[model samples]
Target: MQITASTVSLTVDDVAASQRFFTTHLGYVEQAAAEGFASLARSDAALDVVLLARGTEVLPADQRDRHASGLILAFTATGIEAEEERLRAEGVEITMPLREEPWGERLFQVTDPNGVIVQFVEWVTPSAPANA
Candidate 1:
């Protein structure tokens, strides 16, 4: 089947807080919103985001109170260093400092007001070993 688009739904304690964070810091635009729900999208190819407040009735009985945890919403990005710097200049707390792995993965992380972890990554050619 062809998937036309993608979205990630997150249940958070404060939907508005998460909403503001995504829109203000991540460039997402609000598509729709209600008392406890919000749909956000970006003009680019990035996946959409749906924020649902904890205990929202639309969720199943067992899942209503469950908040998003142990998840990191990662996006492949470019100019990661400048992005990190821009975020820093905007007063965003960088939870994970930018670092490059030996395999050529460069990444950093930030946590929104609702404690949602967002990460941006860039890839480049790995540096050759000094001995090689």
Candidate 2:
């Protein structure tokens, strides 16, 4: 099957809080919203986001009360250093400081008002071995 797009649905205690955080800080615009639900999107290829209030009936009974946790919604981006600095300058708390891994992945994270972890990542060329 050909997939046209992607979206991440997160269940939070306060949908409005997460909605404001995403739209205000993450460059997402509201596609639609209701009393306890909101759909957010960006012009870029970034995945769409849907925030749902906990215990919303749209979800099945078994999963209705489960809040989003234990997942880091990571987005691959460019110029992450500058992005991090810009976020800092805008008063966004840096939950995870920017750091580079030996395998060439550089990443940092910020926690939303509802405690969702959003990470931005970039990749660089790995260093050659000294013996090379």
- Clash count per candidate: 0, 0
1-132: candidate 1 lDDT, tens digit per residue: 999999999999999999999999999999999999999999999999999999988999999998898999999999999999999999999999999999999999999999999999999999898899
Clashing pairs in 1: none
- Candidate 1 lDDT score at position 119: 97
- Model 2 residue 71 CA deviation in Å: 0.4
- Which candidate achieves the best TM-score against the true structure? 1
- Largest lDDT belongs to which candidate? 1
TM-score for each of the candidates: 0.98, 0.96
List residue ranges in candidate 1 displaced over 4 A. Answer: none
